[model samples]
Every structure is written in C-alpha cells, then in structure tokens.
Target: MKYRFALNNDIPNLVRLINNAYRNNIDKSWTNETQYVSGSRITQDQLFEELNKPGFLLMVIEGPDTRSKQLIACIGITFYETYAEIGTFCIDPSFQQAGIGKTLLGRAEQFLQIYNSNIKAINMYVLNVREELIQYYERRGYKKTGLIEDYPLDANLGMPLLDLNLIEMQKTLI
Candidate 1:
C-alpha cells in the first residue's frame, strides 16, 4: 500500500470510495451510518473545495490490486497551528476489516508529525450514534473532548434516519 495526498484526478474515485463506505447500503457492513443515512457522504465539488483549502491534507491510499493502481482508502486532515482535525476518513467497504483503515490512520499521523513537529494533538469527530466507531477511536488512544455538534442539514452528508450529532475525539501527539 502507498499513501499520498490526493491529486486533482483522484476526486471522482475518492467520492465513490467515501460514499460506498459511508452512505451506500449495498453490503457495506463496516459502517453503522448506512442504517441511518441514505445519500452520498460527499460530492465531487465539495471534495474539490476541500482539497483546495489551506492546510488541508487529503490523503489517498493506493493498492496494487488493479493495473492502474486504484485508490482503496482515503482521509482528510486540516492542520492548525498546534493541532489538527481529521475527517472524511474511509476505506472501501470491500477493503474494510483488512487493517487498511488503521494503517492509513497510522501513516497519516506519521506524515503529520513530520510536516508539523509542533502539532500537539490530532482531533476528529464521530457520529454520537455510532458506538462502535467511537469505541474504535477510543481503542486507538482518542479521548472525548466533551464537544458535540449537531449534524448539519445543509452539509449534503446524507439524509439521516435519526437525529445525529458529532462528538469530538482527540489524541495528544506531543
């Protein structure tokens, strides 16, 4: 597996991968969101805008599966002066449970460390309803920061089957 920042040409496939892992209900058992959401997690336009943001690193993980070396996973991180926030993290459902998500996260942390030695923490938000996902992050050393945010209706994330909120999680890297 190879990890690198996504290029301009990677947006479409990235959109597909994220939606398949987050919103699509077609045999995607890795995420709990599928049971609650029924639309694409992100659109190409949104992803393009995210990629162009300052201090935002959209990373893609490519595999040697196909002849073209297709991307199988991805994540987005926005760096602040002394910390960073991670989002848009997903692995293709077909590639889930194979440790790809964990590996991508590990590599991303390492890369961020190299890029910003002053970074003291890595933060992210998990759907409060997704207990399993929260546990996963907790097992990886993230602790809740006592912050909760309402799911945005205009974010185009999806149509929620139930009320949802995002809870903050952070891991101190320093």
Candidate 2:
C-alpha cells in the first residue's frame, strides 16, 4: 500500500525476496525461474553495486499499516538516454495474484514519467523460456521487440538449467 525508494538497508531483504520469487521451489508461483535456472537470483554484492549506479532507481512497496511495515514487492529501474530498463521485479509469494505487481509496475512507470520526462519508452528483458511471464508483460502493453540477447551467465544472477536467452520487451510511454 505504501511505496518508496529502497535504502541501503533493504539489500538483504530484497535479495531474499527476489531469490524466493525466482529460484526457490517450495512456494512456486508463475514467476519462478527454477525450472529453467539454478542458483541464487541475485547476490548482495551485485545489488549493492547496482544501487550505487547512476540513474538507477530501486523502489519497494510496503505492507499496509505502520506496525508491520513488511516489504511486499520491489522493482528496479535504470534510466538510459532514451528509455528505462526495468529489472529485479518481484513480489512476496503471499502477495502474488493480488494485483500488487501490476500496481508496483504502474508506479514505476509513473515515477519515470515524473522524474525523467524525456524517457520515451520502458524496456525489460525476460528469459525466453518464461512464456507465462512474457504473456504477462504483453497483456500489460509491452510488445516483443524481436531482439534476443545472450543471457549474462557471467553476471552470477543464475546458472541456466536449460539453454536460455533474454528477449527484449518494450512499451512506448510517450
């Protein structure tokens, strides 16, 4: 219900939330990547480096009420010269399917429009094997750009269980 920019102290929780959403098999959701990839979704060191990058914005959605203040969702946006890239998006498994991800995504786009009016579009990369995720974005107005890039296996985001590539998806904001 509450959204704000992520602070340095949020890295550990972000790491856990992302890993559980993407890699953990116990509470599998449509977002889980464990079927196609292995290892942690992201590491603290990687997230720390990303947080310090210029033009990067990491936003978190908190649970309603001041007492609990739990992190329910998070998304990362990186502004580029002509557009922005969305990544590191996840919602707590308990929070999935309740429109939280959709609301957070809209908030991220709105933030970009306000903070960087020149940005013409928003882009994100989804693993090619994630058909359901691709459809989710498509339904949200993103179109496949027909661009495929090799997955960054060296980035330590995860190790592929099957051959994997990233496909670009874009939504024009202007």
Candidate 3:
C-alpha cells in the first residue's frame, strides 16, 4: 500500500468512499438518519477547499496494482496548534477490518507530530450510539473521554442518523 496527499482529482473517489462508509447507517441499523433520508453527501468542492486549508492533511492510500493510485482508503485531519482532529476516516468496505485503517491513523498522527511537539493527542468524535465502531477504535488505542458532543445536522431535513451525538475519543501519541 502507498500513501500520499490527496489532489483535486481524487475528490470523487474520496466522496464515494465517505458515502459508502456512512450509507448503510440508514434506519436499518441506527446510524446517521438526517443524511440518509436525504441525498446528503460531501461534495467535491468541500473536499477541495478542505485540502487547501493550512492545517488540513488528507491522505489517500493507493493500491499498488493501479498506476493511477486509486484512493482505496483515506484519513482526513485538521491540526490546531497543540492538537489535531480526525475529521473523516474511511476505508473502502473491501479494506475494512484490515490494518489499513490503523496504518492511516498512524500516518495522520505522524503528520501531527511535525506541527507541534506538544501534539499530545489526536481527537475524534465517534457515533455515541455506534457501539461496534466505537469499540473498533477503542481496540486500536482510542479511549472515551466521557464527554458527549452534539453531532451536527441540517435542521431542515429528517433522515436516518446514528452518530448524531459524538463521543470524544483521544489517543496520546507524543
């Protein structure tokens, strides 16, 4: 597997991956409802802008088989002085349960280390109700801080959503 910064052309594939990561969370199994019912998606423009931000780092894991380096996995991060936030992280479902996610997370942490030596932890908000996913991260060294965060939703629509409430999880890396 190879990893590199995401460029504008990778946005489409990245968006599809993000959607697929959350698409199954409709009314079926208690996930993001507000986005599910509607055709909510992370637009390419949004991604392009985010990637252009000063402290943002979006890395794409490219498969070795393809010369174009299709983005099979991604980890989005935002650095804020002393700490960083794990905004969006997803691997193609085909790559799920593999160590790709962990490797991606590690890469993000490594990136954070450069901006601040005090980069003591990386923060992520997981679905408060998605126990399995929360557990997945927990097993990878993240811990719940007992803090609950409100998951943002566009009030105009009613869609199936699960991670509406976010639980703060942090992993110390410094």
Q: Which stretches of candidate 1 lie over 4 Å from their true place?
A: none
Off by over 4 Å in 2: none
Model 2 agreement with the true structure over 21-140: per-residue lDDT tens digits: 888745556578887888888899988999999999899988876477678789999999989999989998877899989999999988899998899999999999889889999999
Ranking of predictions according to lDDT:
2, 1, 3
Worst 10 residues of 2 by lDDT: 22-31
Ordered from best to worst TM-score, the candidate numbers read 2, 1, 3
Q: Compared to the true structure, candidate 1 yields what TM-score?
A: 0.94
Model number with the top TM-score: 2
What is each predicted model's overall lDDT from 0 to 1?
A: 0.86, 0.89, 0.73
Give per-model CA RMSD: 1.4, 1.2, 3.7
RMSD of 3: 3.7
Q: On residues 1-67, what C-alpha lDDT tens digit does candidate 1 reach at each position? A: 7778898789888888888778774576476377777777889999999899889989898976656
Assess the local accuracy of residue 158 in candidate 3 as a C-alpha lDDT between 0 and 100. 30
Candidate 1 lDDT (Cα, whole model)? 0.86
Best by lDDT: 2
When 1 and 2 are scored with lDDT, the better candidate is 2
Q: Give the runs in model 3 whose Cα sits over 4 Å from its true position.
A: 24-38, 154-163
